[model samples]
Target: MRGLRKYLTPFAPDQSGAVSVLYELGGIIVICDAGGCTGNVCGFDEPRWFERKSAVFSAGLRDMDAILGRDDRLVAKLVDAADKIDANFAAIVGTPVPAVIGTDYQALKRMCEKKTDLPILAIDTDGMELYDKGEEKSVSCIIYCICKGKI
Candidate 1:
């Protein structure tokens, strides 16, 4: 798997461009992930985009938490982080590790919404799934869920 820095670092050079585009469009921006080494990297490019929109949050799932079904910790962390950033909504993106362990994302979603009164989107992007496959699945799910009024 690629290192988080590898994916996130390059975006620093392009931050201005990405932020400008997202700002013009307007909306919350979030990158969900388990607390994997690489998952954070996937999000490196997002902070700038998020900062521009003035809304962003991350929910980091720990390894032990994933195996033990301790999604509450993740939920708490997410809530705290969301509050710190004052995010309007949050996005939940999965990493390879959580997918393998079968984390109960649905429950986490419910908890986050109940606690924060903010919209939560749970995206399944298990690492074992091919890159494109995961991306497509996550995007499709988000679209379908939105159109169905599930989000």
Candidate 2:
């Protein structure tokens, strides 16, 4: 396995300002929630964190949409919002409900990318894992993939 240094170097001290730089360049980071919940993982009440850090776009899914497996609306909303925001990349975060419906996030990602000319990331946050565990696993996976040149 490669050392952590290889992956961490891409996001080092100097590059710590990259996200803000991207933001200034009209890059966006959308956080999708089908569960109608909009708050930080740490329960911070500040909205500016998301606004200042990245262009955060949200899509709250409806119960009917969940039951019928009709994620087209959500995808359309995301694509439209991303286009309007002129985002360079989008990150779609799933909730428990959408996971239960088994929405094809990969397909959604492709669709969104096609429509908006932006890379899309799908994050699955449902079932047996706690939030911290899910976050750790996601970060580890991203790191490993980056080190392997898969991202």
Candidate 3:
């Protein structure tokens, strides 16, 4: 605990912030968690789920999926959802699960981009970070992918 503080940050997790920024952006926002993160977003963080219509979903990652680093399966699921939904882009918002597993969001973005026509915004947001950080991340992703044509 050399550099660790006793108190946790006074901000919400990045997943909540990521979803907030993209909630009305007309794209599919996927929470890369088993279910807890997504539940937090809908049940607590974002109460607008009842009023606003966003294509937010959970990757529904299972135990072995994370253990085996099943990036392909996630990419496939994203692409399939993009095909069915009329979305301009797709966002993969990371949580503690992917963070612990060392998920490479850039590679996932590339994989999703190759398979789907929609632009993919992969925000590698671990649940430990503040909500504003995730908001900044999602905005940065837009700038990097759209402004710089990384898409």
Residue-level lDDT of model 1, residues 1-151, one tens digit each, is 6765532322222212222232332224343344333334335533443444444333455556667878777777777776776454565666556666776667867888898866776665554433445445555655765797755
lDDT by residue for model 2 (67-144), tens: 886767777887777757756556665555566678777787777767766666555555334444445544553565
TM-score of every candidate relative to the true structure: 0.60, 0.61, 0.90
Assess each prediction's global lDDT (C-alpha) against the native.
0.53, 0.52, 0.88
Write one digit per residue (lDDT tens) for candidate 3, span 1-151: 6997685533478889988988998999999999988988887888899887688899999999999998898988888898899998899999998898899998998899999988889898998888898899988988887787755
Clashing pairs in 3: none
Point out the worst 10-residue segment of candidate 2 by lDDT: 9-18
* Top candidate (TM-score): 3
The TM-score-based order of candidates, best leading, equals 3, 2, 1
- lDDT score for candidate 2 against the true structure: 0.52
In terms of TM-score, which candidate is stronger, 2 or 3? 3
Report the lDDT of model 3 for residue 60. Answer: 92
Go through the candidates in order and give the clash count of each: 3, 0, 0
Regions of model 2 farther than 4 Å from truth:
1-30, 40-53, 140-151
- Candidate 1 regions off by >4 Å? 1-34, 37-40, 43-60, 149-151
